[model samples]
Target: MLIAKVYITLKKGILDPQGKAVKGALYSLGYEEVKEVRVGKYIELTFEDGDLSLLKDKVDEMCKKILTNPIIEDYTFEIVEG
Candidate 1:
């Protein structure tokens, strides 16, 4: 079996209003040291054993097609085998 950890985030130069809100809330709650906050998504996936290369390719395709929006977001994943 293999485990995949995926991270999805907005591309650079994209505005993140939710992150900004969180930063503001933190600052109001006495977290003045907080500078910027960016929100992202994390996903964990498990797959049956297969060729590592093929598994990686499938995961990449899944990320591009469904896990993230190609125009507004970027994603990367790490695969762990067991």
Candidate 2:
């Protein structure tokens, strides 16, 4: 079997309101040492073992088509054998 681990995050230079909210909450809780905060999404997909290159292409397509926004978000994925 193969597992695809996908990580999605906002591109740099884009405003992240959710991250800012989390940081503000942390500060309210007295965590002043935190300089910045960024929130991201993690996704795991399981599939039957197959052609590595083809699977990679499919996963990339999936990310581009549905998993992440091409204009504001960036995504990276790794395939692991299980």
Candidate 3:
């Protein structure tokens, strides 16, 4: 089987309100050294093994079409034996 591990995050220069909230919460909790926090998404998909190149293409397409917002987010994925 094949497994795809996808990570999606906001592109640089984009506002990250959720990350800001988390940072604020951490500060309130006295984790004062926390300089920055960025929130992201991790997704795992399991499927039958096939051509690695084709699968990678499909995963990239999926990320662009649905998993991430190309205009404001970026994604990277890795395929592994599962």
Cα TM-score per model: 0.89, 0.88, 0.91
Candidate closer to the true structure by lDDT (higher is better), 2 or 3: 2
Between the candidate structures 1 and 2, which one is better when assessed by lDDT?
Answer: 2
Highest TM-score, which number?
A: 3
Any runs in candidate 2 off by more than 4 Å, and if so which? none
Residue 19 of model 2, lDDT score: 95
For this target, which candidate reaches the highest lDDT against the unseen true structure? 2
- lDDT agreement of model 1 with the native: 0.93
Name the runs in model 3 displaced over 4 angstroms: none
Better of 2 and 3 by TM-score: 3
The lowest-lDDT stretch of 10 consecutive residues in candidate 2 is: 9-18
TM-score-better candidate, 1 vs 2: 1
Candidate 1 lDDT tens digits, 1-82 = 8999999999988999999999999999999999889899999999988889998999999998899999999898999985
